[model samples]
Target: MNTDFLKVLFEISEALVTEELAALKFLSLDHVPRRKLEAIQEPKAFFEVLQEKDLIGVGNLFFLKELLYRICRIDLLTSLGSSREQMERELRILGRALVSAYRQLLYRIAEDLTPEDVANVKFLLQKLLPKNKLQEDASMLQIFLEMEIKEIIKEDNLEFLKDLFQRVRPDIKKKIEAYEGKRKENYSREEVRYPVSVQPEEKGAEGGAAKEHGKIYKMKNNPHGYCLILNNYIFKNPSYNREGTLQDGEAVKQVFTWLQFETVEYMDLERKDICDTVKEYSRKDHRNMDCFVCFIFSHGEKGKIKGVDDECVNIEDLVSCFTGTNCPSLAGKPKVFIIQACQGSEPHPSVKVEPDCSGHLEVDASPLTSIPDKADILIGLATVEDCVCFRSHETGSVYIQSLCEKMRLLCPLGVDLTSILTEVNNEVAGKELEGYKQMPKITSTLLKRLVFKVPQ
Candidate 1:
């Protein structure tokens, strides 16, 4: 999105051309034929309208490839303007983008770089020259053009780049593959987390942490608590899509069985009155509790976790009930919420966007990674905001399978709090289909490292 390089390149080059008394030949002069401009503009037109549709005609494909190449060339010329400083800036930026585009073109395009091409470009980057005298660098561009056609994808100096591509390429290929396969993308972004600012809490400060009635109360625990709230078929959605809900509810129901401080399982309540069921759990004291956890398994959208009547419940409203002031039992403890729903409300491919297409960085909810603080609350979400998170007919969600697996291994090894989550994410995302792969993102804000077993 930043085009300041182009402006600098133009200014520096204009000054140098005048100083050198050189005429604008080749591209700079009006002497180049109009047919060339037509060639450059054609690809821009096609790519602009290019959607997820599979396969473009040869005519269109040729136009797009030419357009992209021409744009890259112009960007190079613009970056090298007459000023040495400006040339350096352009060289750095273009060098990075070219290497990247070269990689992308490797899988997407039919070509690779040649030895002469690589050597010449590498020289231009490492060597220093002024923008007006950019001819030194420009000479190498021809070699790049020749090398572009010959088949060669060098492994030299590309391990880091290759590793990065390995981590992300699967996801990108998934999008391309899915679009080619015409797979549906309806269940991806169901869980949306709106922002909430919580003031820092110091224990025993405000009225010794008072408790209120007729509301969901947070119970105290040293580190945290895992809870399970299961809804019967009365509450589950019965859609037939692969991503649709299952009647068993094992995902949300399994949290309570663990041997930990205070476990609660509330079932069969009015769907609209699910919060009332939570109120019932709050009043029923679990003596000597450590922390708090609430699991809501139902179907809804926006930031609201849903219940039986299909009534969507705002996540904030449900989780807010267990705050220190409201639930003294959890005054100095963390409150964990495990949500089995989508975060995104629209269609999204699990594919990672190329760096050039990196969308505006925005703050949003991820899984354990979205923790707001190094201490306090952790929200383990089901699927990323968009895309279908898989749940086997017998095994629940794929992430949960890998999650429980990691915890089985890491918890006993005394893994740090964050590291365990990290491992779980890795295990889960590692599973791949023909082209589909799912990755879970984490967000947390907990103060303590929890080893998930009886502390010896």
Candidate 2:
């Protein structure tokens, strides 16, 4: 996990401080002094106060941990003089606290595990435990958290769920001991590896433009594809609130043009129109192209992006339109989706850049049919899921500008797409606006490096 992502999570947890008073009462601290509780605003101070009374326990430690994460985010983690040992000590405390509290949290989540909730739990577990190590654990919790569970969970998996329940509430551990056996089918981690480089098809001295293996390869001077830009500026639906994104659209269009793509711009589309446009675009002949680029600028919520009409389209469903199975011409080509939208509505605290500064910025399975796990696709989100992304009414989004700048400079020098995106992440994360910060998330499954070589 990226530290910036952890920082965002910590920042979000700060909003749950309303649970503080209840946490205090649950810890058996009625006898503890008010002055002491008043001083327990930050993690270290709070923990010290708890140390005095030895009150941290499973009943309230989870709340304490949440508070500590917030404290670390706002102050302790960013302090200049904090030693590595001091940081490690804090982590050790958190680790110890979690061991005593995880079962309860896990148990609560298991009681109602929607795929969305499962994704959130998985994020936490991945943060606390190494993914590979978690996979090796025969514990029912591990099995449930595995990615395969997203596809199917039937009667065969019920025993594992029962095992999880038994562990969380040990009073039933003995009663459910018979259900603690291995899953009927254990998931081995998927193997993911890519070739070093794939050569472009030879076209005479002009550069061979021949299609090989049903894949359209790029050539200098002609990209053989289009850049689809969906810029929703004059949002008709008042509920969806319009954003000033024309500058972003123009900037992206200019950059993609410089990169040798023919830009296709769509302004203020309705939700159904957005889907129809993509489906219509997918029908274009892509036999001479190297890849496809789709940039969507809109408001969004968890798992879905909204068009001007406030109608939402699941990002997965939108991207699925261009999948290899649906659009055979792009079967082996890269499909890049750059979404410049808020994944959630939470705004970052404003920072004063000069002195105070301000800043900016899921999966599941189904019954009838689900999007087949697609390959050769890359989605560069402006921010993590469920977070607001910032834009400069003056300069465009922090993400789009940085991305265009980096790609413009890096692609000409032969930088691969992933490497360019890493730089974009660094550039965007380094910026602060009105006390807010943004980080771009890149999810890619390309089997070969995707470098936009400048057409010679």
Candidate 3:
């Protein structure tokens, strides 16, 4: 490296430290160590202290570097007499040194990373490792690092992780179980704890080719799967009903059809009809397809969505019909549910608008049947729980319209489903009617990336 380049590196490193302190201030983290922030001015000394304190591991440092790069890149471009590519090449070289520090830190505390830290490290590894590195190596740590971030943060479930560890690293698995045995449910919220391992694949044979980086297996020629839509637009009791849902159902059908899904549209289904239809469809052979989707458009109250006859159907009961146990054909396969309905009776606070600036659960009760852990399921709600979902009678609900638009555009660009959903959420959330607002929420247990290939 040239002496001038070295000087720029040092300056940028110091600037990163300063930006970090500014970020802490903005985030209002009052207890951040002052000495630590000061030490970052001296790169070598800062890393030394980091290792001594076990503050952050290699993966985390990479993320911080990423943040630092975003913050200081424009300044670096103007100040350093180097091309953008050249600057990136040099920064990557320096990043390797940070990775080296992470490895040393990892040795000092191999199993001590928090779940969030593990997540950050996993992202770094994905960036740094050769493509197919995880696929080529199925060892315990490698597999654990490759699992989904959602799996790491799942609530009150360690069985999946334990099983995976037991299969690969029995010694560590034993220790984990022993610790778990002694633990009580009640504990201080601030205490640090070891992260649980990840669940092993339920169907190992299905994803061999998809193990490649940035690629997923998509069904060829054949329609991927069913788009089961329950459009309860015309209710027997007009007071407990919705309009514009017919249009929403048609919009969903068109989008999914373009996506190569065989759309099965239903309308005016009573509560029993909804249950019967879901069960019937779930029983069919989905082995030939890559995934499944179900969309419901109806009026609903908290925890219960209404059918055409104005009867209440518990949302959980409807969803539970397609769980891994109930829908064995779809086990280990993706099942997506997009629900467009009011989750409660209360409307969002709305104000009168000027024409110009546009904006801008279920119950089930008896018999004590156990609900299986939901895996391979992705649910996207129009509105959050206990909130009214709005519709434009002539157009469609805001969520479906935004979602279909995003799916039409992004799906062809090879964007994964979750990322597309995120964009959909942003688009809907940014929209405003008078003062009313909406933000969609996506809760997923999908293990593989789902990408639709729109034929040219």
Question: After superposing candidate 1, which stretches have Cα over 4 Å from the reference?
Answer: 1-226, 232-237, 240-258, 267-270, 283-287, 345-375, 433-435
Q: Write the per-residue lDDT of candidate 3 for residues 284-327, one digit (tens) a residue.
A: 98888878899888776666767777677777777787887888
lDDT of 1: 0.40
Model 3 stretches with alpha carbons more than 4 Å out: 1-218, 347-372
Tell me the deviation in Å of residue 109 in model 2. 68
1-456 per-residue lDDT for model 1 (tens digits): 113423443353443432121111112112233344234333223222231111112111211222233333344343332233333332332111222333333333212334454344444434333344334444433332233333222322333323433443444434444443432231121111111111113232232322211111232244345464544234344441222123223322332333244445555444457777665555644446655666555445656655555556666666666655556666556666766555554433445421111112111121122332324666766666554444443224555544544443344344443565676675556544323455566666665543344233
Residue-wise lDDT of candidate 2 within 336-449, one digit each (tens)?
Answer: 888887666565554454321122221101111123478888888887655677765534577776687566445544557787788788666665655666666888777666
lDDT of 2 at 111: 38
Error of 3 at 350 (Å): 7.6
What would you estimate as the lDDT of candidate 3? Answer: 0.56
How would the candidate models be sorted by TM-score, starting from the highest?
A: 3, 2, 1
| Model 3, residue pairs in steric clash | none
Tell how far residue 43 is off in model 3, in angstroms: 67
Number of clashing residue pairs, candidate 1: 45
